[model samples]
Target: MGHRVLAVLLLVAGFVVLAPGTACACSCSDLKPADQMRLSAAVFTGTVVAARQVEGDPAGPTPPIVYTFRPDQVYKGEPVTEVRVASNAESPACGYRFSTGGRYLVFASAEKTGMLQPDPGVPLHTGLCMGNRQVALGTGPVRAGDPVLNGDPISAELVDALGAPKPPSAAPSAPATAPPTAAPASPAASTGGSAPTWIIVAGAVAGAAVVVAAWRLPARRRVRRD
Candidate 1:
């Protein structure tokens, strides 16, 4: 009887430790390298012309803020991406910093942006660095039009300190582009010269004024002679 009780106690303790581990495994899984590179390039360096915040879960849980990334250049690589990172939203501890119209470096392995969400119920926004690469915001607050990079000078030095990351197996290939169309010629091209239209008008006006003055002077001399 005593042996059986001791065995039961040991089994329960093992289950207790293993339960959290299993839950964490389901919750957090790090992203792959290729997906990380593609998303980082799209959001960080890409020019955003427009954006708006999306509200979430008023009666449910936490409200979500969503910002869109519009690409100036073509996204040459991946079809999709996803990531979860800390943000500048209001929390119980540090309060709110970023409201809307802000640019952030999102890190994720999968190619689905909408799937990305903040870690539930954690104060103090934690930055998401995908595939060992972290976001570096500029000095002062992170705002729209701020430059973001995977590894900057300071982060590059840190990478050197920590040893270099292993390079990805293969680089993403750029999409094929069609040949550029030539511009049509305009009819105005044939008349191009240095002299402007306003100069010609000014000269004609000056010539007319000089002729009038010469005619008036001759008439005045004739009247004086008479």
Candidate 2:
């Protein structure tokens, strides 16, 4: 009986050690450029300025990686100079891996909610199979008639589906100069150019009269006591 129990325990330990860990499997539908455009909340071509992995929940799954992008051209949604996009940290989870300097066309969705809610600053999220493809990095804004790069078919497709892209809207123009703050009125100006000259004289005269009356009353009180 002891020999049999020992063998059973050894078999169970071997099974535990040999078992394969579960993995995340991601699936996406084949979507055309037009369909992708319609499904995405924002579409733009940008270069990754920075990338960082956000820490995950200790009790949950791995967190997403965030990439900061400097938009070269905005094809859809509000034109922004800078935006952050989040993706799953693992390739098996369909994360789109972005390099620090690589330029790519991105199809991003709006912010997600719940436990995996993206960073508030990162208002968009993307994935590996979301029709995202790398492009030849270039200088200057994309123009309507500019020549397409040798291997950049994605840009051509985007232009066909979404038309010519626009440069990011200027950084909101410094908040409209705060309306010049109206230059706080001078003290004199605030009080409507001070009291009129006559009013000033009247105040001085009334103050003098009060002083004289008080003096005269004190003298009369002394005389009555005598």
Candidate 3:
């Protein structure tokens, strides 16, 4: 009985020591790409413009890392021109890292702050569990400084799942296809337009010729009869 009790206590102590380490790392069953996209709040392709180290609690270890990205495209969520994201510099805090000048296809969460708040109105962030990572180079041929050279379009039925495909840009590109709209034609100016001076003089000359011709025609007809 004494031996059994000692063994049980030792097991408990061992678990206690190991628990902290397990808890510190980002833990999740590895998911397939489709599943990752399904679970993410937003997914996008961006180029890392900067990685700024941030200080956490003074009592804590080194600060986490914040990454700034210039987004070339958004695969999901409301379209935004650019974004900044934060993650742990180390795996222990579940932080992810971003390399300046590198491009990535990021799976991220949008955390909204009040409009009155300073900084980004809403910021994006991701973690190891979210599957934020680099796109395989073979994804596409990219030109220099292309923000989304990180990745090209992902073919998936799930594309429809990304909130109505950003509702197509409000501005219409091909005017031909747009629905015809009726605009009330402006009524011809109610005021009369002045006739040109040359037109008036020509009309007067035409009237005088008609009168003279009519008078001459009568006289010529009478002379012929006589």
- lDDT of each candidate versus the true structure: 0.34, 0.68, 0.55
**Models ranked on TM-score:** 2, 3, 1
Residue-by-residue lDDT tens digits, candidate 2, 66-126? 8999998888888889888888766655667888998877888763432232343576778
Using all chains and alpha carbons, the TM-scores for the candidates as numbered come to 0.27, 0.58, 0.47
| Number of clashing pairs per prediction, in order | 6, 0, 1
lDDT of 3: 0.55
Top candidate (TM-score)? 2
Name the lDDT value of residue 113 in candidate 3.
19
lDDT of 3 at 118: 22
Of the pair 1 and 3, which is ahead by TM-score?
3
lDDT for residue 50 in candidate 1, whole number 0-100: 39
Decoy 3 TM-score against native: 0.47
Which of candidates 1 and 2 is the stronger one according to lDDT? Answer: 2
lDDT tens digits, residue span 1-226, model 1: 5534432332233222222112211122233434334333222212223323335544532333333332221222232232222332323221122323343333322222222133333221222233222233331222333334434322332222322222212446798898899786543443474456677789999999999999999899999999
Identify the runs in model 2 with alpha carbons over 4 angstroms from their true place.
1-22, 111-121, 139-152, 155-157, 172-226
Clashing residue pairs, backbone N/CA/C < 3 A, model 1: 80-111, 81-110, 81-111, 81-112, 82-110, 82-112
